[model samples]
Target: MQYPEHLAHFASLFKKRDIAHFMSAPWLVSSFREPVWRYNFGFKNDQNLDWRVHLCDGSLLTDPQHVKLLNSLQCWLIASTENAAGPGFTNSWAAQSASFRRTLTVIDHILQSAEALELVEHGLSALTYDVMCDIIEQIGTSSYVAVSTYDWNNRLTDYCKSLLQTTSPESIDKCLEEYPTLADITPLQLEENELEIPLELISRVRAALYINKMYHSNPNGGLNVNSIRVSALLYKDTLAGKKRLKPLHSILGFIWRRDRFIREFDGVPVTNGNPDRMTRRDLVLYRTAFTFLQKISALDFKLPSKEDLREIATFKVTGTAMGRFKNVPTPIIFKAIKDGIELHFEHGPQLLKSYLNIAKYSLKHMVNITGIPDETTISLLEPSIAELGVQYLGISTRSSGRDPGTELKESKEIYFSKLRGNAGLLELIGVYYGAIQLLVGATMAKRGSELRDLDPTNCLSEDKSWLIARIAKSSRGQKGRRARNARPIDPLAAEMVQTLIDFQKDLIEIGFIDQHLPLFSSPGIIGTSSLTSCDVYLYYKNIDLFCDYFEVERDSLGRRYYIRQHQLRRFFALVFLHCGYGASAGILQWMFGHTDPAHIWNYITEELPGKELRNTLSQALSERIATGGATHYTDVIDLIESKFGTRNVSVMDAEKLAEYFDFLMETDQMTMEPVFLESDTGLRVDILVVVRKQDEMG
Candidate 1:
């Protein structure tokens, strides 16, 4: 094959004799040509000479192991040179020989050093005895000697060789029967201070396995902590050459090994020559390393701290069952209340205060929604308000005029009546009051009272101030409710109210309310009455603002207009009529708080249309239902799904589902036939395929 110019350049770089060039431009040595270099450099102690000689020689360092051996030999030569030339050097040949002999001594010293051995030991930390045996079986003794320093120290070399030879698959099985402690051999080697294993190497192996698992499982492949941990161990073991398994085979091999271990020793004693109770120390070590890697990987690498590493390691040790001989302990939750004042300072006091007020309103609305007894809801909210940092004066159980609760109740009723008179006003006040306060407060806080009080009437008028005070007082009373009542309202209901109120208050203090209020309110004047009118005008003027506040967007003007409070009764009446409760008269009677059907009929006959074109659609729907027509229901669904796609079909996809629906509708497929899309039971499948063919003729 013809090589690219870059490859030719790489070849030349590899052939260069300059040591500096070889060291500095190491990337020039293509991985493909590594074998050639390896063969030439095998187990040679030639430090002064360039790598080009080793690459050209071909005989010695053919294998990667041989190349490593030669590199180690060269390192030994460098270390030994200081000890050479003292006694046996009369000639240059004798001097060279002495240097070579000293190099061997240095190599032997390195093999004996605890530090060097510790590095190797750490590398093997994630490997099991059986795995180590497998590695020996795969790599054989020669490569092992090159990668490892066993050749330098006879005693250690002999020990390793014996261990390797005795730990064959069959031998290991027998050993398990005789000595369960054999499972701890890797740890034993470390304990004896024989080798140092690098955690990095183990981590790399684990990472490879994790990536593979992720790739295979993708989407539906469920990943659990245990599986991930196991995968990591397998990866580490494979990479360290402690397991005779390929990278692709590690996961399966690990499972097989686990099964074999379980099957071979079902009830044997763990420590006393029983296979059933094998300690699995190697597995534990690997698991521990895996856990450490997982945590450290999750942390921000840019600011890696020693404390973080120690915490990760500690968690890994405990989390991975490294020390425990039995089941893991459950994590303990520790709780302590932080000072509220301090928390307020950190989070902004005004914001917190606003949250409390919002929480109160939210709770009140929730009570209204659930039709829970007002007294019970109020009792539940009292403590919540106290906790929220509101100082309460007193709660009057009796509805006295002097009591703030009674005052609030009266105020709320008045507010609601005004809402009935002009529903827009209620919405406008709800939308803007808190928001405007927040914006003005923040701006004032940032600037000064001089700047803040500029539009005091507009920004903090007496009416607005009274509104704030009333809301605050009500919130405090509401918070007390939770503490006093043993049996409270539904937990979710309480939480929702709390969350809504807090969110509203936050929006207010941040100036979001003040900024958007002008879009809805009347444009002129600054008197209290004018302000009230503006609030009322805003309430009705920008219905979209209210919808926006609730994150609910009306799709059509009809839908938007239909949302009016007065229209609600009419709509409900129409629904009843279409469902066949008589005409609009009966609907109005049932819907308008009228007790008698006859009165509703008179009103309907005298006024509004008893039925309309829109009502016809509803009547047709009801008729189809009465006739048990599947086609009608199916057609409805087809229309909905065609309009909304997967979004309208299920709640799981949520926004995505909605987006899909929008896409379908916008693409002009509103009348398209229904498609039975393949989907996970809980998942929404967006794409649609036509279930029925369209007519060929126009």
Candidate 2:
């Protein structure tokens, strides 16, 4: 803060620079404009952060004070660059790289964030700029590097571009005249015959040469340099740091590494391989998770640990969905009037009855019509089944569900031949299978392969509490693989499994399938085969088509939220971790099929959004405090609010909100929980803001 000659130095520079251009443009002094610079065209910057720091698009400009300072600086801006892009700052200022604008952007961000208005009241001076640097490094080191490094290579690029512009190609090629200092840099483009020169590329060199020439003649002060405004500029990095994040496009290369080449495609013929589609499906697994995290981290939000990602991957069943049904054709759906069948997930027996009735209808038409069919069996699936399904669901075209620019292109093939499974039967069955799998997977939070291996005879325990799911992953290539009896399951999951058991038992009773087949068996696609057990790959392939027809969820882009089998497992682990479910680490280890305990331990202890959600809750509370609103927990809320002093935490001291939220969580070991309990009306979900541990009896 102590600068002996800082005041004297700034006063000297203020007198030297011409200030006439400050008024050359009238808009700079007029009303304010947002995005005072134009660069990033991304998510709506609802905060309206516009000050033409013009780092990438523009800099952060906030409040009335910045407007006047911007007016004074317009003289320097106009002298060095071009016209303003909207109300923001101009591009190509002082012949700097587009990236260099980010330097000013970061500084403005810090000033506005810290509300250090006094530092900028006279524009950034030498002393104020030094104070800003100390504040910046306190935030993060890598952040400062990302912002300042924009202009780091300017000196080198200037030297190379200038040296190469004057030299002939032969001299450099023969090594007769070489520049060893430029070996690390990329080669420059220089057209000897062209009169055009890139001003931004060589301006630094030209300025230095001009200053050297003037100094040799013993010019005024022997300094001959006047670019002092830049020297006083401190690199604040939050804005510039945001611009340096991992771009969304590089996801293509992130998933497609050389080591990831499909093993099956290596020795086998690549004849039908589309290269794009064929390889993309094979590229999913842990790598997809890595890319997902990388994308999350690039944004300002904290990167999710295992628990947060699990929430994204997990599906929660709503008890109310039982009454809802998307109509598939045929009066069988209306048979509720006669057969006492109702559309509900819990009424799995009624759903099976309807499915069988539809199956019987197909058999009657096929057998009575003669010549085309010889048997009246459920195995002989008719096209009428699909005709019914298609009435309510459109066939999938096998294409993208995400933005073409943001997502990888899909590769899918449709068979032209109308085989037995081709007659819409497979599509309908696949739809049902996908929905079943989605619910079952989320409920069990286990691998699809393991779920498929469930014992139809006794997968559900006597009490219907534990689902005897086989440990396929942990049991691989080991002796006497066994199903875990301790795997606790939801009542809904037990119902779903029992539903599958009843449906397949009828198939086995009529000789449609062998009783020994896995619980996931379905009517075979092959003409001669009666049944085929479902695998992870088969279900994965059928899922997309099923999601197309089913009333599955979609993303913000209106694309289907592609829930994968693996995502389900993560959901189970996360629920147990955050909600403090009965499952222990030992139980999770056996369920997750991990080779080591550390993997399961890490997941169990992974940072929950509870900590992050604390901030969000604080923000919501702060907003309430700022608005002085009424709420249900009046006494408790008043008590909490009274802790803060008169200064508004939301506006006057925004940083204090973190402390207040921390206080709420620390008091009485309060935790946010989603619990359902029996009320006089029915079971109701509890969504309390501040839940006391002892008050939770459910």
Would you list the C-alpha lDDT of every candidate in the order shown? Answer: 0.27, 0.36
Task: List where candidate 1 sits over 4 angstroms from the true fold.
Answer: 1-428, 431-531, 534-539, 553-562, 565-570, 578-590, 594-598, 610-698
lDDT of 2 at 543: 46
> Can you write out model 1's per-residue Cα lDDT over 1-698, one digit (the tens) per residue?
34687686455323423222222111122332342221111123322222222222233333454454344333323223222222112334333334433233223323233243342323213233333233323222222222322232233234233434444445445534553322321211121222232332322222333333422421111221133333333222111111221122111111101100001011111121211111223223322322222222222222124444344334311111111011000010000001211322333333334333433444446422123333432344334233433211111112212343442354534533433232221232333332332222211111111211122223222222211111111122113311110111222222222333444345445443433222213211111111121232222222323223332222223222102222222333333333232223333232333434344334333323322212222322333233443333454456555555632333322223222332333233322221223235321111122332234212
Q: Which candidate's lDDT is highest?
A: 2
**Segments in model 2 whose C-alpha atoms lie over 4 Å from true places:** 1-423, 473-483, 524-529, 551-559, 573-698
lDDT of 2 at 427: 44
List model 2 lDDT by residue over 1-698, tens digit each. 33357485455323432334223432232323433444322222211223434322244444454554454333333322232222223543232222234334334444444434344433433213234334333222222232223332232234335555665555454432232211111101121111133434333333333322311211111122222222223233233433332111110011100110011011111011211111111112111222232222222222234444444333221111011111111121112112211212423344345445444444445421112222222333334443332221112221123122221132222221111133334344544555566656754556566776666887888888777766653432224455364556656556666777788787666554556566766543222123455543345534444444432444334434345554454344333332222223343333444324344334333322233334333433433444444245444455455665443333433224434544556453344433334446432223246545445533
RMSDs, each prediction? 29.7, 26.1
CA lDDT, candidate 2, residue 261 = 8
Clash totals for all candidate models? 49, 16
